[model samples]
Target chain A: MTPFSYTRAGDAADAVRLGAFGGAKYLGGGTNLVDLLRETIERPSALVDVAGLPATIEEREDGSLLIGAATRNAALAEHRAVRSHYPVLARAILAGASAQIRNMATVGGNILQRTRCAYFYDDEGSRCNKRSPGQGCDALDGFNRIHAILGASADCVATHPSDMCVALAALDATVHLQGPAGTRRLKLTGLHRLPGTRPDLETALEPGELITAVELPALPAGARSTYRKVRDRASYAFALVSVAAVLEADSGTVREVRLALGGVAPKPWRARKAEDALRGGPATVQAFRAAAESELADAAPLRDNGFKVELAKRTITAVLGDLAGVAA
Target chain B: MAIRINGTETRAPADPRVSLLDLLRETLHLTGTKKGCNQGACGACTVLADGERILSCLALAVQFEGRSITTIEGLAGQDGMHPLQLAFIEHDGFQCGYCTPGQICSAVGMAAELARGAPSAVTTDLGAATVRFTGEEARERMSGNLCRCGAHNGIIAAITQTYAGAAL
Candidate 1:
């Protein structure tokens, strides 16, 4: 790894100022940042470790969960309020990496985690637009199985590898930020951008912006939500197509449904089209399949990843069906 | 920065980027923690950070300033070996033994979590702190640690026996 000056951020203001000093990266859990550093993908001149910040989870009087950005994944997953109110978030986080990683990774760092694109990690000689702008995308043709199937542009086809963000999307969470300019709040959907013209600009944060906390608005009362991830093996693998379904049915009719897909898009895709089809509709396997197909109709899969369409359709159907009590 | 590892409070070397795995193995001359993937994928570099298991390879030594870290070298007593270590030997839980240190350290942390009533993904009630440790639970929790020697069955056997003994 490259030799860099390490400074501990005394507060959020200090972190932002240090970050604005230029060529400095804020280190949270150091899971992905350290890995990228070792691989020479990221070469920052200095690192500001912000792990000592007050990263605790708290419940407000309004039943909202204000989760500290520095809160570790293990702590968030095991939090009593989070487990009871937003079980989907807990389950999604637990389905990721491993126990050891969950213990190390922070909530903000996990959401800011980079794509697992093989081409992007190829420091030797792979044309990855995300790693280097104006470069060609090798995943468009080579070993494109794990490439994005949605919201992908010609310049890049890398899927966002975050299960927690998918659940946050379904829960309608907002990210609280503190930067040199000021403080602001942005929706989860507005945080991660698509691999459009600027695949390099992955997030909406400014250079010196630091995420302080993540706030989850109260979930739908008595909503049966679950996160189902499909990977090659049972655990320790990235998602092939993960679905976070938050559903509330009334007398066998879908009252409200929120659907988000991971590993299929450059961002945590909120499947509003699918949700529109399922809402107020009969909660059946056929209806679920149609809803999935309706949203996936926009999918322009590559040759190697064409099978993802079918897998996504099946996953959507299965997850919704499980919540709806349908034989899938 | 100084950290308490295996009950000993020690200072780290000069490099700020040195990982906790390297600090323990290379700097402290404690080779109990092994480095496999160097990334977080392989649990071969597992160690306890404040009684919770973490990937030491992915952890910067500077970040662990005043925390208490426990490695495989701290698991046993002066008399013999830790129960988990003894169970591993009895079940032949290793072949080449390259991943044994990390596996044992991870198991130690896992038992602490179970004792604390932490729940896994398979838990039906997410809010229910108490959990039942079954073979399936062990498999899912231990998925981060890979054993190329395929000594998985024996590893499971040792963990299972240890859990049973602890319960008894």
Candidate 2:
């Protein structure tokens, strides 16, 4: 690791002030940043520790969950309110790294975790545009098994590896951020950007901006939600294809539906068309299958990831069927 | 930086870049905590902070000021070993023992979580305040601690036996 200065921030203001300076990064939990620093993936001049920020789990007046930025993943997953109301989020967090990692990983750090692209981690193996701008991408043709099939560009095909972000996008969670300019809120789905021109700018967070909290709105009554992640191993492995779905079936008809996919796109892939197709339709296997098919119609698979198209479709169908109370 | 390790308070030079794993092993001579991956992926350097398990590999020594830390050596008492430690010994829950400290510390924290009614990802009822310590729950909770010796079956059996009669 490179030599750097470290200072503990007193509060959010102190963190923002220190982070606003050039080549300074806010440290939270240090689960991802520490590893990145050691690997030379991230080399900041200074680290401003924000673990002491006054953050907690609280319920707003409108029955929404407000998760503080510094709240540990373990705390959020084990919170009574989160387990009872937002079971999908809890399930997503539990499906992540592990009990020990979850204990030290904070909500803010989880949201800001970088992609697990092999090329990006390798400083010399393959030239990654995300790691070094304008250098080119090696995952475009080499070992593209885990590359994204949707919302990808010629410059970068790396997929987002967050299970919790997929669930948050499907639930319409809001991220509250504070920067040197002030505070702003962005919808979770809009927070991420497509690899349009600059594949390096992954999130909408400005420089020196700190994520303060994440607010999850309450779901409708009688809504069934689930998060299914498919990986090579049972635990402690990144997702190969993950689906987060929330469906409401009223009297044999689909009332409302929300779907988002992970490990398949540059950002969380929200199935807007699939949700529209399911709304007001009969809750049957045929409808679920059709929705899943329509969602992946525009997927552009790489050489090794063509199988993910079928796997994602089947996973979505199974999840939606289970949520809609339909079975084979 | 002042921190408590294994019931003893100690201070180290203000070196923020030193990882907690290195501080324990090199500075304090607590070499029981192994460094398998040097990253957070492997739990070979697991330790207890205020009775909760954390990855000391990624933890900065400066961030742990005034916190209580426990390693494998702290598991035994004047009388005998902890229940989980004895169970591990009797069950032969290790082969090379490189990851034994981490497994023991993680199991200690996991047993506490089970006693506190924490649910695992495989738990069917999320609303259920109390989750039973079934075999599946134990497996899912201990998935983070990897053992190359393939002693998982024995480890699971030992943890089950230790927590079987407990209220967790």
Candidate 3:
């Protein structure tokens, strides 16, 4: 790692103030940032350590779960409240990285973790728009197996690699941010930005802003949720295609459903069409297959990743079927 | 920076950029913890903080001030080896032994979690307050600790045999 100055922030204000200085990065967990620094992909002059912030897991009066940004992934997964109430979130965290990485990775760091695009990490020689703006996206044409098929631009096609964020999107989780502009709340679904002309800007978070916490609202009664991740290996590998689903079944009919896909989109791909197909319909495997096909109808897969469409469709069908069984 | 390692409090130069892995191996001379990947991708530098497994490579030395840390060296008692350590030896749970320190420390923490009835992702009943420590459960919990030596079969067998008769 390059030499850099570090200051442990006394409070959120101090973190923001320190971060407002040019070439400053908020250090949470350091699982991703420190690695990037070592590779010279990120060269922040100073690091504002925000790990000591008082933010932690708490239950709201309205019965929603509030997760502090600094809350470690392991803590969040094992929290009694999280395990009982928001199990989808727990499942997502469980499917991520590994036990050791989860212990050091924070919720804020998980959200802010850059894409795992191989080209982006190739510091020696590679064209990556996310790494260096206006350079180019090498993955667009070469070895685009894991590239995004939804909400992608010509500048970049790298898909978001987080399993936790896909569940958050399906649950409509809210991101609570603190910065120089005081406190602000944004929907987690809108947290990521599409790679338009400016592929460099990845998130809605402004410079100097810190993610304070994420709030998960209560789900409807009879809500059954599941997160299914498909990876090359059984463990310790990034997802090839993952699905997060929450379904409400009533008397064998799907009353409501929310679905989101990871590893296939620049952002979490919310299966709005699939959800619409299932709502108020008879819960059946055929219906799930139809819904899954509808969701992937517009997927434009690259040469090598054409199999992803079929794999994702089968994965989604299987997830819906499993949840339907539980509902039954 | 002050930290309590293996029941002893020690101090190091206040270098915030130094990783806890470096502090243990370089500053404290606790060479039991190996560095496979300086990045957090590998669990070769796993250690315990307050009995919880954490990647020391990703952890800053400054963040662990005053916290109790335990490495593989602390596993054995003055008289003999810890039950898990002995079981590992009996089962030949390692080859080359490069990833042993991290694997053993991680298993120590994981075994504790099992005793506490932590539910893993593969747990069938999420509503079950307690989970059984079956071979599958052990493998799922220990999935983070990779052994390039391909001793996973022996490692899993060792942990299973050790905890099989226990309450967990």
Q: Model 1: runs farther than 4 Å from truth?
A: none
Query: Measured with DockQ on alpha carbons, how good is candidate 3?
Result: 0.65
- Model 1 C-alpha lDDT per residue in residues A1-328, reported as the tens digit of each score: 7779988998888888888868898899998999999999999999988776769898998889999899999899988888888888999999999999999889989989999999999978899888989988999989999888999999999999999999999999999999889999999999999878899999999988998899998877868889999999999888989999998987889999999999999999999999999999999899999999999999999979998999999999999999888798
lDDT of 1 at A50: 79
Residue-pair clashes per candidate, as listed? 0, 0, 0
| Candidate 2: residue B168 Cα off by (Å) | 1.5
Find the candidate with the highest lDDT and give its number.
1
Clashing residue pairs in candidate 1 are none
**Model 2 score (lDDT):** 0.89
lDDT of each: 0.90, 0.89, 0.86
Q: After superposition, how far is residue A219 of candidate 2 from its true place, in Å?
A: 1.1
Candidate 3 local lDDT, A154-210, one digit each (tens): 898888889899999999899999887788999998899988877789999877889
- Which residue ranges in model 3 land beyond 4 Å of their true spot? A326-328
Tens-digit lDDT string for candidate 3 (B1-168): 479899889884465678889999999899999999888766889999999898888787877876899998888898998888888899999999998889889988887777776777787766677777788888878888889989999898888888875877
Candidate 1 or 2, higher DockQ?
Answer: 1
Tens-digit lDDT string for candidate 2 (A145-166): 9989999999999998888899
| Backbone steric clashes in candidate 1, count | 0
